[model samples]
Target: MAKNKHSGKIVQNSRLLVGLVLLVLSIPYSAEARQKPNILWINCDDLGKELSSYGNQQVHTPVIDRLAREGQVFTNAYANAPVCSSSRSSQILGLYPTRLPILNHRNMSPVALPDSVPTIMQLFREAGYFCSNGAAGDLAKPGKEDYNFVAEDLFDGTDWRQRQEGQPFFAQVQIHEPHRTFVHDELHPIDPAEISLPALYPDHPLIRADWARYLESVQRADRWVGEILDRLEEDGELESTIVILYGDHGRPHLRDKQWLYEGGLAVPLIIRYPNSLNAGKVDHRLISLVDISASTLGLAGLPIPIDWDGKDIIGGAKNSYIYGFRQRCGDAVDDIRSISDGEYKLIWNRMPEQPYMQLSSYKKLQYPAYTLYRDLDQKGELSAPFSAFMATTKPDYELYHLKVDPYEIENLADNPAYQGELLRLKEQLERQLQAVETYPQEESEALIQQAKSSSRKYYQEAMQRRNLGPDPTDAEILDYWNHELLLNQKPKTKK
Candidate 1:
């Protein structure tokens, strides 16, 4: 009986030893599972720093304000380009748009990234994470990726939910609000009287109404943000995902969309992570949207490509000044470059002989604000600040002390007192352009002409079908010039 009892005790000890070994083996597996965090990147179109959290009292953005409260808000974040396609192209490829073929907005032939240049999504997919653009319902059309890019193979699907269980994900959700054709929201209407007009714009009823519509669109965008956050919380993935929300560029106002002013280049950026890195803090560091791709790669524990121009803003060295580039926007042709160190801004307009406000059919026909400015200019009722827009010619160089003149009304480039600062910025701009191997605007225009030929044929056909009159005004002449130069065809119809 004694021998039997001793044997039973030995058996119990062996079972306990086996259980202990299994637990030790599972520890590494569990740690590995938790190492890879999900990434959620959200981007909005034509949105500037209009959020209430950014001190815009006219617009109510509760959802975004809540995000700022929970995440890190960047005060001086800027887009590399003021327009959409170019800015977004620079963002995804981690390189300046000037370095790529798609340096302008709405290129007739979309430029594809070289195979050697891997996107952040591609990097994440190779690292064993499921990647997607957004939910399947978010697709605007069947089999059409919303943004520019011919590389559709990078994303696994439209929805991250389709990913395998226990798999991490990298998803981009693009919200198309506050762009053009501002739709009024009855539920959350904005009061035009409350909006503070900028010094550059005349305070007319029409201008006020337009500004109100923009604010309303902002509120509408906020609601969409709330929906996305709610969906994440419901899925129980809020605690495991890192969220980033920002705009593609500045607002769509004149001199704001295609120009290099703060209204055109600056954007709001908010980031949140489960690790709470600088959570609920406002970072005043100068950051560029180009840095987003590399910063994301760093956060995911992946290596950034050496050839990429972007740097990790969160973990890497901060930039002294952010740079901006402007090429052709729609029918307008321009070559403007700028650099700002968060206090002073320097702009170099290569074509100073050209007018600041070019003839753009899209801008003229679509926006009532443009018509109002034209009428006011003709009547000679526009104030000095407002009259600058209608100037016949622009200065070759413009320098503004942004600290004192936030609206950029004064040009201090000619002032002898600012000569030292101007020289410093000019040298920096030259170095940056050389480093990126940026081509002259003429080279870009030549490529644009080649692509515009096809589009010109289509537009000419449409004009003939509509029985439109001859090109008389500057706007019409410019459009016709673009068409004629590309297609080498005269108009069949007459006035």
Candidate 2:
């Protein structure tokens, strides 16, 4: 009779233990849910540091400004490349562009990112979050229509409104505004005269008109962002969701997009995490867009994949260096490369003997600034700002001490006084590039050969063109300058 009583007691204890396990499982979150944070990545095309919150008082971006009020703003953020394809690819693969074999701009062939490479969407999906994407431009994968979701409007609030009730999600929204080919008539009410032009652009009527249009696009993007934020608040998911708003690359112009200069690669990065981050915080550390991948994974409590070249920047401090490269043959130039360490920037040219053109720069051609530079150069009324766009017949290397000259108006590469700093930076760049495994085996040979051939061809053609002399009214020289600068060899040997 005592043995039977003991057996009944053991059975009752087992039932109690089972009941406790079920209760814990039924809880909304028991340390497991925190590990699966919903992620939202918002990207803008050809957008740079033009937001009022980032200290650009000219451009109005209230929604992004509000996001800054709620979270951290990284002032020194940079893109892997100045172009759309390579920059987007780096973020998607979580690796640097130099590591990729075919991340060149305008290369119609799809540089297939391997399925093994875990994207931010894929990472969250594996960790129990549904991944969805809405793109406004053709910057992402070319033919992959279903890139996880099929939202009709890339910038609209359709997808964000239809997420599953209790499940975690990773949603990416893109805005098509603020891109080039802008409509000039529909600009914001801001007066063109009040705008402070960059040192590289000439003060001409056409340029001012174009700048107005660009600002208008920014306002449109901001309005749409406000709509998205309001919806999030209405759904009661604003606090739990992590919001990331940033640009793919720099502005569209001669010296901006296809070049390795600050105008091209330097981008605005804002992260809004209501539950995790403190408001009005500013991080000045150099962080790359690729680092977003690791940061996202880290926030989700998942380990960063080994193949990624970016570091987790959520702690607000990281590596001091930022690298940028470009590969596009536009107008009159070929390939180029560049790197920056917050204060200094260096550019490597395959073709060094050619005079850098100011009016024909890449970004200028796409916007109204192209006419301004041309008219100014033709009239010989070039100001310090317009002159800044003219690239010198740079030596094999072009270096600038950004702290001393933020506009990059001076070249210090040929100056022997700073040889130590230059050499040290070069060595660091080489080491980091080598550490990335994605660099193609034939990169050196291809770049060296391309550089030599391009130099020879450009030299011969330029001499012929120079002999003809500047036509008193010819706009081609200014046009050529703008074009050549944009084409300037910014090809990144993606290591």
Candidate 3:
């Protein structure tokens, strides 16, 4: 072996050649493995699970249906808080809103995030990801970051396309549809008679008309989603991005928005992984909006913060139950908390003295069901189910098994047979409350007076706008709304 130097040199050259070939082969694989996913969170305000994808044919949401068909569907996702500000605050940080004291709709003076807590956007930006919050509107405007926190200039820009070349981006695009002031979508009109009105409200013509308008708004929102997805596809970002489409909360209606009922807490969640990975997979686990943040981090190949309240649900691990709470939305000071394990749900109305249909300014002006409930009670026509829920006072605790009672009208808190389930959820709530900031038990007199005064003034003004008398009957109210819906017909004369 020591005799031939040329032969030794030839064998050494051959070994080096093989090493170079292997190194070259591994570079592209390593780069591909290290490549992070761009995240696009498509949020539609006040949208419910009414799309055709969710089995509501009245809602014509082709774009969202396609997303459902091509992605993983979460059948039982909920907003941790019903209102926008609280839910957004909870999800953005992967923590409960009470811990941050962002439970209110909008604090007159918002508190900035503490030094210790970092937002998901903050984490992504630290990882060199470009973060953008923009409106998915016709105009390229800054997105509605209606977070009850100080969020001015927290984002890099309003456009994900403005990111540095080859940089991954996290974009939150707000589509304000089906929120309020819903009118008939002329382009996509839904027949009022076709709407499936919930049993919680009076089945009046005005209510049906309003529900139809709500679906029309959803149809409009669906078009917005289609536009966003098309733009991504045109830009060659669709296949590389993890697109998440969801409602911030439930539909803005009588029992839905700002309440702890399933209508308010439940939201439809659809996630399309890059290249349609795991398409058509449906997850029936109970999940909260907060889990989305941690899951997003996980999908992006980032380390989730250990202090975060949410877990990485993308790994198939799920929470047994999701929680929801409400406090001081629209000047109403009733504190409510709810827990649901997908089938069973519980509500704790800490201040039951405040009625469910309290003097909330926006509801009086926007919701027709509010008027029907008040008018029916005055005539002593309010019956069992309606009277129980719309009474002057509410029960301290209400429980329902949603699998059997989808409407949640029947209260089983006192039912002897359901004592075990009630106790379980009650104990769970106590544990949850202990971990967060203590809730305020007493209502502020000043806030109550202010809210009532504002509500009465707005209500009277709204009535006047509809050409209604000081004490108009339900028929009169229906007459005006019917006229509004029928633009081709002559307007109804004021009484």
Expressed as tens digits, the lDDT of each residue in 1-495 for candidate 1 is 012221122223323443454356554224454568888888888899999989988787999998888889999999989988888877887877776555666665554555455567766765567877762235332222334445557678777777877778888877777887686878887666777887767787667767788889888888888888888888888878989999889988887988899999999999987756667899999999999988887887766666678889977659998999887776677788999998999999988877877666556644556656776677788778878888988899999999999989999999999999999999999998877644223445566675455445544565455344423343454344333323335643445
Cα RMSD (angstroms) for every candidate in the order listed: 13.3, 13.0, 11.8
Those runs of model 2 whose alpha carbons end farther than 4 Å from true positions after fitting are 1-35, 135-158, 183-188, 329-333, 353-365, 371-394, 441-495
- Summarize candidate 3's per-residue lDDT along 22-47 as a digit string, tens digits: 35654422444337788999999998
Give the range where candidate 3 is weakest over 10 consecutive residues by summed lDDT: 1-10
Q: Give the alpha carbon lDDT tens digit for every residue of 1-495 in model 2.
A: 012221122223323443454356654333565446677888888787889987889887778898998888989988877777678767865777666453455332334444344456555544546666665433242222222111232221226444555766677777766786553334456677788887666666556656766777788878767766776788887888989888888877666776777888888888888675778889888998889888877776665665467788994438778887665432334456677888888787756655556223233334435455556666778776456554466466778898878767677887999787788778877776666534442234455456445544544454345442322123544444333333323322212
Question: Residue 425 of candidate 2: its Cα lDDT?
Answer: 77
Candidate 3 clash pair list: 134-143, 135-143
Candidate 3 CA-lDDT value = 0.79
Pull out the clashing pairs in model 1.
none
Q: Whose TM-score is higher: candidate 1's or candidate 2's?
A: 1
Q: Which 10 residues in a row give candidate 2 its minimum summed lDDT?
A: 1-10
Candidate 1 deviant stretches above 4 angstroms? 1-34, 135-149, 275-277, 438-495
User: What Cα-based lDDT does every candidate model obtain?
Assistant: 0.75, 0.64, 0.79
